[model samples]
Target: MRALCWTGVNETSVETVDDPKILNDPDVIVKVRLTTTCGSDLHLLGGYIPTMRAGDVLGHEFMGEVVEVGSAVQKHQVGDRVVVCSFIACGQCWYCSQELYSLCDNGNPNPALTETMWGSAIGGCFAYSHALGGFAGSHAEYIRVPYADHGAFPIPDGVSDLSALFASDAAPTGWTGADLAGITPGDTVAVWGAGGVGQMAARAAMLLGAEQVIVIDRLPERLEQAHQHIGAETLDYTKDSVVAELKERTGGRGPDVCIEAVGMEAHGTGPQYLYDQIKQQLRLQSDRPTALREAIYACRKGGSLFALGVFGGLVDKFPFGAIMNKGMTVRGAQQHGHRYIPRILQHLADGELSTEHLATHVMPLEEGPRAYQMFKDKKDGCVRAVFQPNGASSTSY
Candidate 1:
């Protein structure tokens, strides 16, 4: 099997590796049909997340057919088409029972590693890093899925592979942010970043009945997609002051909900961007939180702010004062994909949600390295670079 292996910072290659086999009673082998690069994967490529090794496979969002299943895996069998969650979970854990699958207590194989950094171990994630879980990623012909019954949701009839592929991570993560923020009718929402997750978050806000949906990013192509596909008003942060533009648009009150989907790799402007860049280069801070700070400052008093982006470590000069003075609610989580994938699939089946446009660049898995480079650079309007391991039909170029 050929897999995309992360060899070093900003380096990856396609290397042949051993095929996966069923390892536990709750496990199954999935022959990957489709997989895609995520913005979070950019964090891994840029060395923002820690504990990655030379030979680690690098992918998390994927869907496929079940090739083999353990005896205990009764919900699925050979040939069952399904989308697996990016994070692993144990169904019997207290958090899983509460529908917080990402915080499952018994998922991460190496809890001590994460506990030292984040104070506790999160649920195991496919190819995220050693601290999260060292599970092999999905950017290959096949992958071993643990706790199959809990994490794998069957693709409903009529949903294309392209649509189900994102339900694994991007769409669900965006939906998680909107759901947690409690978007209500007439609420105004602003999302930072115009990548797949941000686009989905903007669409989710509108679907949840928010009166206005605004997307922020520096990229013209992404902003155009937000305007054309999701009916969102877009702001190019590089061209306009985000805080001022947001305030003016909302009649000087700011948005009721602000979502930070740009994560640690946010491109900042002016002094803060320069300061964060210098600190990051010197290893003084693990995250560059330009978008997060703006989100906090731009949110209305008593509003909600959700951090949908991946932050591996501590940030410098976060505005705790704004949060305190304004009585804001802040929340973030890895996508609880198990809790949301099913509903998203139903929406896809019902023609209520369409993700066909998000897969902007599609190529065979052999071009994994180039695909990632284009995605990371946002070249040629590459919103989501999807790789078809089986070379299945694609929706777009």
Candidate 2:
């Protein structure tokens, strides 16, 4: 099998690998139809997240056809079109029973690293890192899906493959933020970063009956996509004062809900950003929380803030004062897709959600290296680069 492998820091390549076989009774094999790069993958690519060894297969968000099923996999069979959640959950654990699937106790087989770092381990995610179970990812012709009954959701006939692909991660991640952030009807919501997850979060806020939703980013292309495709107001942070503009737009009260979707590598305009970069590069901090700090300060008093972004470890200059002084509710989580994927798929099937636009570049698996470069550099207005491993042509889409 040919798959994308993380060769080294800031490097990736297409390499031949052994095919996956069913290892658990609830496992299934999926012949990947479409897989896309995610912003979180950048963390691994840059070596910010430790324990990622050379040749670790890359990718997580994907949709495909079931090629084989294990003895205990009752919900799916061969030929079933399915979208698997990036996070692995056993579904019968205490966390899974409580609907907190990402915190499932049985997910990450290699838990020593995270347990040592964060005091306890979270769930496993496909190809995230060795700290997250070291499962091969979906960026290949086929992938092994464990806990198939809990993790795989069938794509509805009305939903296109391109549309269903995001249900595997991005959309459900957005839904997780909005649903868990305590978004209320008629509330004003602001989301930082106009990427796929940010745009999806804005859309989820709108669907949740937020009176107004705003997406902020430096990229005009993504802002335009948020405005035109997601029907949310867009803010260009580079051109305007984000905090002041947000306050002015919300009648001086600020946004009732603020979501930060830009993770550890957030870019900013001032000395603070440079300082964070220096600290991160020197190993003084594992993450840069520029957008997160801004989100906290910009959030209204008594409002809710959700960190939807992926932060690996310690960050300097966190705004603990603002969070404490403003009486804001703060929360963060990896996507519990099992709880939200069903509704997201229904939304996609009914044409209520649009994700095809996020796939700005679609290409063959051979272009994996170039695709990652383009995606990481944000070149050519490339929002996401989708890879097809089954001899699918780039022009076919």
Candidate 3:
């Protein structure tokens, strides 16, 4: 089996590895049909996320056909097409019952590893790191999906593979952010980062009844996508002050909801951003909260700010004052994909949601390294680089 393996900081390669076998009663082996790069993968590639080791498989967003299923996996069987959630969950757990699959108590096998950093383990994620469960990711020929009944959702008859691909991660993540923020009718929503998740968040805001949806990013292509596909008013953060423009657009009121989809690797245009960058590089801070800080500053009084971005640890100089003085609510979570994948699939089937545009580059799994390079550099408007393990025949769209 050929898979992308993380070897060191800023380095990865295709390595032929041993094929996965069913390890748990609820587990299933999936011949990966399609997988894609995520912005969060940049955290792993840049060596920001801790506990990643040499030869760790690296990818979380994927969908595939079941090649084998374990004894207890009754709902899924060989040849079943499914999109597995990024976060592993046991449906019977307390948190899972509450639809909080990302916080499932029974998911992480190595609780002590995350307990050291986060005080408690959240959930096991495919190919994130040992701290997050160390499950092999889907950027390979095949991947082992555990808790199949709980996390794997079958793609509907008419949903394209490209649409189902994002249900595995980005769409659910954006939906989670919007769902948690409690968007109401006529509310004004602003999303930072026009990447895959950000674009999805913008679209979700519209679907959730936000009267005005604004997407912020420096990338013109992404902003154009937001404008054309998601029907969002786009802002170029580099050209205009995000806070000022958002306030002006809202007629002196900031956005009612602000979503931060840009995580620890946020780039900045000023000294504060530069300071964060330097400190982060020196191991002085665990993340760059540039987008988060802006979200807080740009959120209206009594508004909500939701973080869908992946922040590894503590940030320096966060505006606790802004959150306090403005009476704002702040919340964040890893995507509880199990809770949202089904609904998103329906939206895809109904033509209410379109994520096919995000798949800007599609290639065979053998070009994994090059695809990642283009994705990382954001080259040629590469929003999401997708890989087809079985080549073109595996693609349904």
Candidate 4:
């Protein structure tokens, strides 16, 4: 099998790899149909996230057909179309029982690394890093899905493959932020970064009945998509004062909820951004929290803030003072897609969610390297470069 592999820092290639087989009684083999590059993949590509070895397969968000089933996998069988969650979880853990699927105790098999780094390990994600179980990613023709009954959801009949693909990660991630950040009806919400996650977060806020939802970014193309597809207001941070404009738009109160979807590689104007970049490159900090800081400062006092972005490790100049003085609620988590994917799929089936527009570039598995370059550079207005590992046709299923 040919799969996309992370060759080195800022490098990727298509390489021949062994095909996956069912490894456990609870596992199944999925023939990937569509898999897409995610912003979080940039962290691994740039060497920000440690433990990513050369030749590690790269991808997580995907939808596919079940090719082979395991003995214990009852919910699915051969030929079933399913979208697997990015996070791998075992259904019987205490965390899974509590609906915190991403924090499932049995998820990450290689837990010592992350346990040492963050005190405790969270969950495993496909091809995220060695620290997250080292599972082969979905950027290939076949992927082994562990805990198939818990981690994969059936795509509803009316939802297209393109629409269901995002339910694997991006959309559920947005729902995680909005649902956990305590979004209330008639509240004003602001999301930083107009990428797929940010746009999805804005859409989630709107569906949650937020009176006003705003998405901020420097890209004209993403902002336009936010307006047209997500039906949210957009702000070009490069052209206007984000904090001031947000305050003005929200009647001097600022946004009731502020979500930061731009993670480690956040780009911004000013000395702070340069400082972050230099520090990150110098190995002084593992992440750039430029948009996160802005989101905190932009949220109204007593408002809620959610960090939906992926951050690997420590960051400098975190504003603990503002959080203390403003009485703000701050929360962050990986997407617990198992808890939300069913509803998201229903939304897609009902024609209430729009995700196909996020797939700006669709190519074959052979174009994996070029696709990652374009996606990482944000070139040609590429939001997400979708890879059809098995081919573009869905008729085979």
Candidate 5:
């Protein structure tokens, strides 16, 4: 087998690797058909995630066909096409019983936890390294699906793999963010960042019945995608002070709900002191915190602020005061992927939710480097790219 292996900061490539087989009766093997580089993958490339290591398989968002099934995998069998959940979790865990699958006590792709819970440590889903259980990722020819009954969802017969690809991650992640924001019919929502995740969040807000969705980002192409295809009002952050501007547009208070779609690799000019305080010493390098700052500042009193973006470090000057003073509710979570995958795909299959417009490019998995470059530089028409494994056929819309 061959896979896109992590090779330290700013490096990766397709390389030969050993084949994987079922480790548990609940497990199944997936022949990867399509995959993509998520923003979190970039964090690994930039060395922002300390747990990632060389030889680790990369990629989490994927769609594939079941090649083999463990003894207990009764619901799935050879040739069954499925979309993988972003994380592997036991459906029977205490957390999963409560719908908190991402934090499942026995859930994995995390080594220490796996060792603690299962009496030993083993790998998890592909590409996410040690901190995440070092599972071989979807950026490969094939990957092992642990907790198969829980982690793999059957793709409907006519649904495009391309369209359902995002149902695995972005679509559900955005769904989680909107749910946390407590959005209601006619609520005014404001979202930050216009990445694949952010654009999806904006669309989800609309589907949830938001009367107004204003998306903020500097990328014209992304903003245009939001405005034109997504039906959300767009704001170019580079052109103005987004915080002040959002408040003005919202009538002196602020938006009813604010979603931070940007995460730890967020960048800004600094005196070195600021960067050191927020990034180096504490380890959170994502700009989502800064967007959180804006969210707190711009959210209407008694409203909500949801940090859907990943936050990796302790903060020095976070807006604790505003959150306390404004009486705003704040909540967020890693996508409980298994919990949402089915319903989100139902939306996809029905044409109620379409991310086809968001996927701007597609190519062979061998083109990983070129795709990374396009995303890092925010190339126009490069909002998202899907990786089609050689000799594998899967449509991600």
Candidate 6:
């Protein structure tokens, strides 16, 4: 089979690779259908993540048809069209019982596992890295899904991959971030970044009953899209001061809830610096604070600061006194995908959320590199891109 493999920092190539087989009793093998690139994949490409190696397949979010299953996989079977959970987990783990499958004792089924490090042998999507569990990604003809009973959810009837795909990661991650902020009816919520996750977080805040949702980003196209389609108010961080605008919009007190969806790959980088960092340990950041340092100061004293963005390693200075004086709650967790995918899918089935708008770009899997360039260059009005390997790919795209 041909798979998109990370050859080195700032490089990837489509290479022929071995087919995956069921290794765990609860595992299933799925023929790749609709696999998309994620912002997280950019980290591996840019070398922000140290564990990603040459030849590591790098995709996580996907929906496909089950081609085979192990005897222990009782909940599903071959030909079951399903949305593969981004996080590999055993539903029976202590963490899973608590609905924290991202922290499941059996984490990703990555190959670089040490007995102590891999916990109880659960894992996340392929190509993410050992830190996320080194499962080879689905940017190929097929993928191996471990903890199938725990992670994969059947795409409910009447659902399209165009919409169902977000259930794998972006929408749920947004929902988790908004929920962590403890949004309440009529509360003011400010979200940083206007990407799929950010837009979804804004939408999630709205769905959770926030009176107003303010999204901050530099891209006019994305900001406009967020405003026009998702019913969000917008602030361009580059053109305006996010803190002042956000505070003024919220009537002097900043949003009651603030979510940072932009991860460590801080925006505003040229190719040289971007490439230099690709092979080395690069700096991580909190774009929320970068956009609204005043958010900490301007928050409603007891407001919530939700950092849903992934941080690669350490961070620079943050306003400790601001946090101390405000007495706000701060929380973040990986998308507990298994816990939310089902409910999120149900919402999609009901037409409450439409990922079709979020998918601004779509192409064949062979254009994976170009998709990355378009997304990195911030071209093609790209918010997110999906690659379809099989002829059975979604019709809308």
Quantify all predictions' global Cα lDDT against the true fold. Answer: 0.91, 0.94, 0.92, 0.94, 0.79, 0.78
lDDT computed for candidate 3: 0.92
lDDT score, candidate 6, position 78: 87
TM-score of each: 0.98, 0.98, 0.99, 0.99, 0.91, 0.91
Please state the error at residue 101 of candidate 3 in Å.
0.5
lDDT of 6 by residue, 1-397 (tens): 8888898888888888899988878989998888877877787787766677788887888888899999898999889988887877778868888887777766754534434443344445556787667788988889998888878889888888788887888888898898877999999998888888898899889888999998888898899889987899998766876677877887787889988887766553345334434423433332213433445655677889888877655444567778887888878777887777888898888988777787787778888888888888789789888888765554434
The CA lDDT at 313 in model 4 is 90
**Cα error of candidate 1 at position 133, Å:** 1.0
TM-score of 3: 0.99
* Clash numbers, per candidate: 0, 0, 0, 0, 22, 10
Give the higher-TM-score candidate: 5 or 6: 5
Model 3 per-residue lDDT tens digits across residues 186-264 = 9999999999999888888899999999999998899999999899999998899999999999999899999999999
Residue-level lDDT of model 4, residues 71-162, one tens digit each, is 99999999999999999999998999999988989999999999999999999999999999999999999999999999999988878899
Model 3 spans > 4 angstroms off: none
Off by over 4 Å in 4: 395-397
In model 6, which residue pairs have backbone atoms overlapping below 3 Å? 46-278, 88-123, 106-122, 107-122, 107-123, 108-122, 108-123, 108-124, 109-123, 126-137
Candidate 4 TM-score, C-alpha based: 0.99
* 1 against 5, candidate with superior TM-score: 1
How well is each residue in 1-397 modelled by candidate 5, as lDDT tens digits? Answer: 8787888788887888888888888989988888877877777787766677778878899888999999998789999989998877888867889887777766654567546544654334446667666677888888888888988999987798888788878888888898767899999999988887888888889988999999988778888888887888988766877778888888878899999888765543235336544565354433335566767888999989888887654444678899999998999777777777898888887877877777788888888877877877778568887888755463444
